[model samples]
Target: MTTFGSQSDVIAFLSEPSAYGVSDLVKRIDTHAAIIFLAGDRAYKLKRAVRYPYLDFSSAEKRRLVCKAELALNRRTAPDLYLEVCSIGRLDDGSLALGQGSPVDWLIVMRRFAAKDLLDAMAREGRLEPKLLRELADGISRFHELAEIETHHDAVGRVRSVIEGNRVSMAKLPGMPLAACDRARLFTSSLVLLDQLTPLLARRGEAGLVRHCHGDLHLGNICMWQGKPVLFDCLEFDAGLATSDLLYDLAFLLMDLWQRGLRDEASLVFNRYCDRRAETDGLAAMPLFLSMRAAVRAHVEARGSDLQPDVKGRKDKLVTARRYLASAVGFLDRPEPRLLAVGGLSGSGKSTLAARLAPRIGTAPGVRLLRTDMLRKRLAGVDPEAHLPESAYTRETHDAVYAALLEEARKTLDAGWPVIVDAVFDFPATRAQVEALARAVAVPFSGLWLDAPRDLLHARVGTRRGDASDAGPAVVDKQLERDVGFLGDWQCVDARGDAQQTLEHAIAALGSECPIG
Candidate 1:
């Protein structure tokens, strides 16, 4: 239906690789989208020049809508990368110049990023770092804080329209498995609960949680920009698709992480986001979203093989989509969690474990981590790294801060969310309080008391920097002398040697999302 390489000028530039050493510059397409090379620095995206029930990529106004949606969403974390949408023109001499006439076509120009820095490659080479995931978690939380929420659309109206459309697509597929039908139905029921949560969903939009978001987030769309994570290639063709739950938006990337088989890294990313956000109220939003993403993938595959007669060739992708849909259904079945808590003496890698173990649990998008030091500082109206006198650690301050942490945990868990509570819980009273709360809430809880040779702790603490926990080498002696009360509810994990090695052992104990007996 379309002719690529027909434009000789464009073809020549692509075929003759430039200085950045780009080679694979042909073209790629899905049912609704297509991408073409415009030099190594940018790519031009054009809608399939078709209209559908869910998306109208036909008229000029429709094309403009997509362009605006993509530009706004991508500006969230990668403003510098996505330049603009320019008008394409057919000149009098019959040539195409960007931004030239009455706009014969529309395109999104984005700065190109390297492929090898992707999480998939990083996972394959075993080069993913907890610190990087931690930073990425922080970055995403910041983006959510600034996003615009959906005000006009009810949760059911917004969500079901997309889900049900996928059901239609699944039905149209060559031979969708029976399991997929079951999964779509489960996802449908979950949307029923979502309808009840519409008011809250709208409140979140009012609170600015829903903004135009990078609609198609995956490892390939994210890159390390100046040692920071930058998201690009946002959904440019559909505002309705882009305006949805923050968790739903995040699920796409999380799904990509799992698909890449970086389960540990996925868990770390999940927990890290949760820790920073503590948006436990959004927990119920996960199933609805995760299912929708899986549905999207299902429809995507069905659409990909729409006219390709090789029915056998598409079976593998169909099966993959079917499994993902079932997984979405499984989350709706409410699998009970085995809560694994990461705790330790100051600077003993407890935070690291919490960050890494989260994405490994469910197909959940991101993790939530609760840091005592940061919470304590916030309670006292001070910056995380601000000097806290010994008075700040008094009995009254400790009680209030811990109470807040416990309350946060309740809120986080009640929302069906996972979190890493970063605290010493050194005193038996503190440890016991956490255990009792978890039992009262009926949430699975695990306590890991992280430790190191006292000398190692001393050395690490002596040189710690840029963190809020005020416990230094000077405080280590006081901590050591203090009664490390009640060791009953916790397991002691050695936090010695290199930090990464310590994390490897902890991840093994946590097991993969699909735990084997």
Candidate 2:
């Protein structure tokens, strides 16, 4: 039986165009554990013959099993990308061949996609659009819904192990980029937060929030394929590492986006995902989740520095590692969250102002928005854009919708995330309800009342299409006839002008009360 001497020989074989039965050039992409060779329309991923504390692929049989596992697991999300696991054997002439000779190694075949389609590349080029992020969030939420829940898994123990692993990995790095004091503080603060959240974490595990997730969820592992974002390259070698709380899995992507200076995009994704899943109660764990995700990247970058061939590349990676380390500390110690409410008649630009201000309200991804229109749709079990009958607008339904909004806002605020409530609040009771909630939660609250000409309101709502709001000119007329009780402490902002002007006016009025950037 012909056997390859080392992984280098296998890499060399795969690096040639003849290996892929194509005349085109072959390109190689290397990572710590796998080498991917791209030729023509196909890509082959070969696992390295290396043994690490967390993973072992030292034997050919082990590599084969891992390759099969990867293909099976990744096909869950990226079915079009993962093809099959092929055996690499030898020919009669002692030459290497695929699926023909005595097995020496194995490779996972995948469909090659354009590098520019990678979400990381799109972010670097400022090509990540709002529509794309919304769709991506929807897809992620659906994926989490389908993930297998591990009822018997110890969620606390798993997180503690990760924290300990991070500690050991970072401490062992030669010439560690982080200060010893800072590293110790990060770990201590993370542990304290974990202790505080143990009960809630245990409840979430019991409620089946912990599942087998896409362990390595980040921009680099996602790509735009067939006009949508597809998640691939999941952590397959270790099932324990791949299984965790669904929110923790999502926190990796949120941390990645925030660290890339895409705060608005990050906030949009967060709000969209929460709207789909009603995951507001879990917001309390975001700080710890975000911090741990950042810490994971910090050590990973530091470890990558050791593999850099050049001094400059190694130094750059170390610098990046230090930056990520600092971010980890920052995420764990964010400022207190505030509660902002926008009240106005239908079509008075409250929704626009709330969306614009959300990213600047509090921490990295900003706040959760609780809009009456969206809540009504969610309560009715319909899509946000679906039209509702007039019966859905009864006084009882209105009261129910407002009650749901206030409850969600209270839950989100108590979870240490800022909130923006968008509703008419045309009655004294509804207005008092939200204000009382802020007082009960002991959070800083600011309410903005939008004022606009009746004609302007009519014109705005008349042109609406495919919006979550179902307000029309007739609805605006009804709101105008209704007496919205005295404004009290709420500030009035002029919405007669364009959306930007209204946003600026609202921000100016909130300057003293809200800590918006």
For model 1 the local lDDT of residue 463 reads 79
- Residue lDDT tens for model 1, 1-517: 2222233443333334451256655443333355455455666665445555455666656666788777776777788887888776667886556676566656677776666676556666777776677777678777777876566755446666777776666666545553655855765677776676676666666665666666787776667877877766777666777777777788877766665566776666765565566567776576567666766775675555544457675666566666666665654543343345577777686766665555545445444567788788778876556779987888899889989888888787776765567788888888888888789788777777888877888888787776677888767777788878768847777789576787766655544532322
Model 2 regions lying over 4 Å from their true place: 1-5
Report every candidate's CA lDDT.
0.66, 0.88
Q: For every model shown, what is its TM-score relative to the native structure?
A: 0.79, 0.95
Summing lDDT over every window of 10 consecutive residues in candidate 2, give the lowest-scoring window: 1-10
Residue 466, candidate 2: C-alpha displacement in angstroms = 3.6
CA shift of 113, model 1, Å: 2.6
TM-score of 2: 0.95
Q: Kindly list the per-residue Cα lDDT of model 2 for residues 152-253, writing each as its tens digit.
A: 989888888888878887887767666798799989999999999898888899999999999999999999999999999999999999999998999999
